[model samples]
Target: MNATPCIIKLSHISFAYPGSDVDVLNNLDLTLCQGEKIGLIAPNGSGKTTLFHTIMGLSQPRQGTIELLGKPMRTPKDFEAIRTQIGLLFQDADDQLFCPTVLDDVAFGPLNLGFSKEEAKNTALETIHELGLSGIRDSVTHRLSGGQKRLVALAAVLAMRPKALLLDEPTAGLDMDVKETLINILNSLDISMMIISHEFDFIHEVTHKIYSMENGKILTDEEVHVHQHEHVHRHGRHPHKH
Candidate 1:
């Protein structure tokens, strides 16, 4: 074993929505180490997004505990500190892009961290360049394409220089070329990540390990290569692989 310290840890975490009878996360336990890429896959309504929300401190677990960067989170202040080190990429890019221009949007996090205005802008520009989005540095965010918005959202998070990233549906609306670009960018980063995506191929390419979720529980934890397979089925008489 490599013995790397855990950057994020959840212990017996359980959560349910208001007025709902069923818990979305049933005593879930998970951990992420530095520099590890982990993938999560599950059917719709299986609580993948809920898990992300819980980790991001948007949804509190009714029981158990959450630790980010080895610090236990017990209150909103604790979570706020945790958020500084664990950046979350919401499924919708619009939720993260609020500033007037791309540069402002990307610099928002660093500015909040008390960086000088010039320092924040420099960091934002460097992150945008890394994502191959420098051309839109000063462009209006609302006028950008869907893929550009997603990249901008990611750039905003990257500018914060988080130790770990919680990404949900990162490649959902991206084209093949954009998806490839994102994969390359993510691979080049030296940070830990827990990515939830329905795109199995993309997950396999980006992650070294995989976990399956069902009924609000993790069903299995295995190496990505172990679960690689081609499933063939027929819609009519023709065969297709998925």
Candidate 2:
């Protein structure tokens, strides 16, 4: 048996917003091991964002248990304790970069994590440089291009030195060059991650496992194959693993 640690686990999770009977996350489940990367593929409104929110404690599930950092996660406090360790890249980069300048935005999380002001600034600068973002370090956040904003958002997340990342539609609205750059950046990182994306080729480029969600359940191997994306992933004459 593999001995690697499982950092996150979602079991029989179910949820529905108030006054709505339809469950966005109906008995959904997922597991992430140390250094394991996965690509979650499902159509829009398949509880993808809801699952991310639930993991971060932004949304509460109606049923099931969540495990994080190898322990049961059941409270707002539990979520808060682990929040810094699990970085989430929202679908909209704009939602993440609220600070006036790129440097401030990158330094924000570290500051909240109680880093000394000097340490936070230094950490942010290092992260920005490592991501090849030094060019935009002092730029106005709102003035940056879409791809630039996305990269800066990522830089901010990395400054916290998280153990895992949850990236939602990370490559959306990016040009081919910027998409390639982001892909390369993600590949170089050794941290654990679960990437939510509709771009099959992009997903295949990064993740070790391809997880498909259907009717709110993460399909077993017998239930599906390679994220239900055999056709699209191979659209460019690229073969996928069986």
Choose the strongest candidate by TM-score.
1
What TM-score, over all chains together, does every model reach? Answer: 0.92, 0.91
Q: Can you list the residue pairs that collide in candidate 1?
A: none
| Worst 10-residue lDDT window, candidate 2 | 226-235
Give one digit per residue, the lDDT tens place, for model 1 in 1-242. Answer: 76889998899999999999798899898889888899998778999999988888889899999988878989989988778888899999998899999999999999999999999999998999999998999999999999999999999999999999999999998999899989998899889999998888999889888887866777656522334565545575576444
C-alpha lDDT of residue 71 in model 2: 82
* Cα deviation of 179, candidate 2, in Å: 0.4
lDDT of 1 at 121: 90
What's the distance in Å from true for residue 37, model 2?
0.5
Q: Against the true structure, whose lDDT is highest?
A: 2
Candidate 1 global CA lDDT score? 0.89
Q: What digit string (tens of lDDT, one per residue) describes model 2 on residues 9-59?
A: 989999999999999889888889899998988888888899999988899
Provide backbone clash counts, one per model: 0, 0
Off by over 4 Å in 2: 220-222, 226-242
